[model samples]
Target: MKVGLVWFGDDLRSADQNILWRAMQEVDFLVCLYCMEPHHQRPSRYATQGMSENRRRFLQQGLNGLNATLAKVGQTLFVSSMDADTSLNLILNEVPISHLYRNHHGGWDEQQTLKRIENQYPDVRIQIDHGLSLFTPSQLPFNLTGLPESFSKFRRLVENVDSTTPLPSLHKLPPAPSFNIHNIMPWQHQITDNHSAFTGGEEAAMDQLSDYFSTNLPNQYKAMRNELDGWENSTKLSPWLAQGSLSARQIKASLDVYERDHGASESTYWIYFELLWREYFHWYATRYGKQLFLPGGLTGKQTQGSYYAERFRKWSQGNTPYPIVNACMKQLNETGFMSNRGRQIVASCLIYELGIDWRYGAAYFEEQLIDYNVGSNWGNWQYIAGVGADPRGGRHFNLEKQTAQYDPNQNFTHKWQGQVYDSQLDSVDAADWPIYPTSSN
Candidate 1:
């Protein structure tokens, strides 16, 4: 009986996980492994920490949950701080392995890592499953290279295409092969006791989905999704989705059940529409490759801005002149979450108002967001910076107009805006700024 190894990357859950299911079927014994790379903890090029404390804490909770879940199925997840290649080498040397199974990711960095592994081990029977996206390349109506540049065109083509059904839940797994490997990486960060709305794990993700759909929230989602704050205002599923604790197909499956039971409305269908947007960005990342990360973005046009360190710092710390931007930034800095409309508004301010390099903002979001997906993060930044797929070239939101409409009563703004600090800018008069006066209503 040949031993097999399953490497868990972003795909952490056992439910709807094709890689884990197929590995269990083919191997007599299996070992589940995860690599905690040093690069993930270090500061990025933009000088922001690669992963924020909030996100790190969430990841730790998720890992602990996954280990407990695996233990129930007679398996254990071995975690190490070593690089993926070194970790895999240690496993192969210690145990006689015949198969390696992993979920495929569309990011350039992730793809490069897989390529390096293949080069190092030529004889291993590696099987890569496309579990990251709702639709795979082969399932697409056209070749990835020829994917439509505009999202609306792409959505029109594939809106009716059915997603493959999610894999059935696994209740048991083959016992892991015993191996003596030490030097397991210890989680050094302190888990904060901050009261967060989200808790990590497969169970939590499913519970959240069930709770949201069980209410009238889905029916009101289309109308309320743009609001600045509130749990019920929008479906808070991205964090789980980003970590692979929840799969797109799983969400779609739940949506199907909801629509059948409650009757489908534009709101019910709108959830599907948002999922398509996520799918578009996932495939777009693969097609564009390294260009997606480049300063020029997919269009190869240079963004018209230079890095302004002080200005960016003020924006990030929620000390900006605009109350709406400040409040949104404060919310993101405090909680590992922000509304979709808030994201667009802040992104527009960074690119158009502050005139800082877009990559810095994108990199900062990567560090801070609990639900950060490389494709969506970078792709959307490119769109706002006028380098990606927006027919209008770029998005520039009028801060005054946005605030008047979205934060009219100043309820959302007041909740997040803390004590005012000294202005980072030298000459700007705080009183002269057009922000909604804190003294008024």
Candidate 2:
């Protein structure tokens, strides 16, 4: 009897889940697991949390939703507060698992966990299926080593590639192996926290998908996508996409249906275009691996900034000299989200104006963003810092120009209290001596 154990990472929903569907075919009994690793809750060298209170609660909501989704089909999600390696060890010892299954993820730490599992349990037949990405690596037009260096080049090359289809929902799953999992709770156990503008879970993901396409919203997405505030300005499906409640392929499939039904426009096509950018970063993270986190990134070019305690603190707290940057930061802190344009503007301010390390900004986003993905976050940061995939070097947005263009009416700025009267950036100089505050002219 082949008893299977599947470790679920960001991909939580059981519907359109490749691993869950496959496990039932290959194993007589199965265990579905998700570990809420402690590392995510701790602080890193930058002094920000690996995960913030908002992020943690958002993730818990995903787990709770995934758990409930699985329960409807007679399966359960076994969650753990312990680290993944220990939990997998404890389960393998008791389950006699002959097979292991999981959705593929591009995170370095997640890769390390898979390696540990492989070495410890050579006898288990581990199978990884793709649902996280729109296209599997094999489906890519080129080898992973030959992935395009620029999003433009990448987009041009893959313009004709076929879209991927989402797997059908699993109506029923294999029974559990009946082995006791240590430090576990019933599937109904839930930890609720301050919910965000977006709910976390697959059901909500599908609901949002339906609601968005059910309207003329897709036609308007391109024009308003860059807006700083309006909720309907963008697809707003990212939080769910990041949590694996919604797959990239699922979104692509929906886009196809929407285009066919509503008629394709540039806005409809731009939706596809944005997804390709996401697809590029997913491959970018996969190809670069640990380099994605490095300062030099894929290019190995030296970055301009270093860590500055006070400037970083003020920038993060939305008390920066630049009101637009401050507004963007305030929006991020309060809502656990930021518009794409807002991210780039504030990222440029951190790297160029404040002269704080780009990694610090990326780490802060990792902590705060309800929609954080390892690849896109770091890759875009590297691009902003002029160290990553930008063939033309880094981007430095004109804060004044950006403020005039995006927040001309100052509606967004006023709403978020962007006009901070911070004449002095730091209270102390390098020598820890008192520095006179300057007047803002």
Candidate 3:
């Protein structure tokens, strides 16, 4: 019997999972696997302790759901903390692996890893399918090479294109192919910190979608999305989407149905527009690649002066005296999330307000956020830092002004300002504003 091996990464769900779907079609027996990179526990550019405990716990929960789904369909989900290259080699030597399948993530590190694997195991047939975006790059009207330099142009061309790619359905697993294999790693079971309030798995993602589209909250999304004080204000699907627990297409489809069955309005389209923005970032990263990670970023301009790790820490911890900025940072530290408006404001403060390098801030977010996607995080950092597509150089948010607009009554700021949320927040105490060298600074 032909054997198929799937090395799952960010694409965690069973539904609409092209990698799993294609694997089932190609081979009679399949081995589903997940490899947790060993380096995940080390200090990253942002979090010194690696991925925060809360994010990992949430991810573990999602992995459990994925495993259960596979089990229901007669498949076993094997997991490891091994490096991709080493693990793929082991699979090749141990199993009758005819093909290796996975999703194509745009990050340079992930691409590099794939290249190394193909080089090491040249005989295996490797397939990369689109499982992340609602519409894959290949499925888009324009190629990455010809993708518009500006988001608006890209948005215009693809706005009306059919995003009808159906989410792949799960199927029963054939008997396991004969192989000399080690026992599957047990799930890293841990209770997620209640502070974060985000759950994992395809089930949780779909449940959240159902709740969002439910009549009680559907119409209020537009007005509530910006409110920072309560979970009721936002869809909160971002963590799931960021971690691959949810697919963008699924969210878009649900929204579309809500519009048709319920009624379309400015709020309905606004959510779709936000999804487009997410698409723009993905395409932007695919087009730009490593440039997105550098200090100057996509514009090719070198950042001025030296970077201070101390100052970067302050911003990450949210201790900077600006209560509004600190409050948003605190929320992120405690819950692994912040509202969209909160994200923009804090990111701007790190760049324009703190005068630190944008990469420092971007890296910090990547390490902490449950929804951290390379494209969106870095793409947004470069945009806010004035290094990416924004012709205006940078998008700066005035903290006091932002506080007035988003947290007008200071309720959002006050919610997390003191006692409970300061463990990490105190690291970046904003006791006094840094002196700017120039008026712009």
Q: Using TM-score as the measure, which candidate wins?
A: 2
Q: Roughly what TM-score does model 3 have, to 2 decimal places?
A: 0.90
**Model 3 — which ten-residue stretch has the worst lDDT?**
418-427
- Per-residue lDDT tens digits for candidate 1, residues 9-97, read 77778889888788778999998988887788998888587788888877877787678788889888888888777788888878888
Q: Is candidate 2 or candidate 3 better by TM-score?
A: 2
What does candidate 2's lDDT look like per residue over 273-373, in tens digits? 99999889988888889999888887887877898777878888899888888899998998899999999999999999988889999999999999999
How many residue pairs clash (N, CA or C atoms closer than 3 angstroms) in each of the candidate models, in the order given? 0, 1, 9
Error of 3 at 210 (Å): 0.5
Question: 1-441, model 3: which lDDT tens digit per residue?
Answer: 688988888878888887777777789988887887877778765435677776787888889888888888888777877776667778788887888888878777788888988887788899988777768765688777887877778779888876865566676665567555454454544455454567788888889888888855766778888777687887778888877878888888888889889898878877887788888888788778898888888778876524655556666776776788888888889878878888888888777767777777787787788888889989988888878878788888887788778878878777887223334322332666443332211
TM-score computed on alpha carbons, candidate 1 = 0.93
Ranking by lDDT: 2, 1, 3
Winner on TM-score between 1 and 2 is 2
Look at candidate 1 and tell me the lDDT of residue 23: 78
List candidate 3 segments past 4 Å from native: 45-47, 178-195, 418-441
List per-prediction Cα lDDT, in the order shown.
0.85, 0.86, 0.77
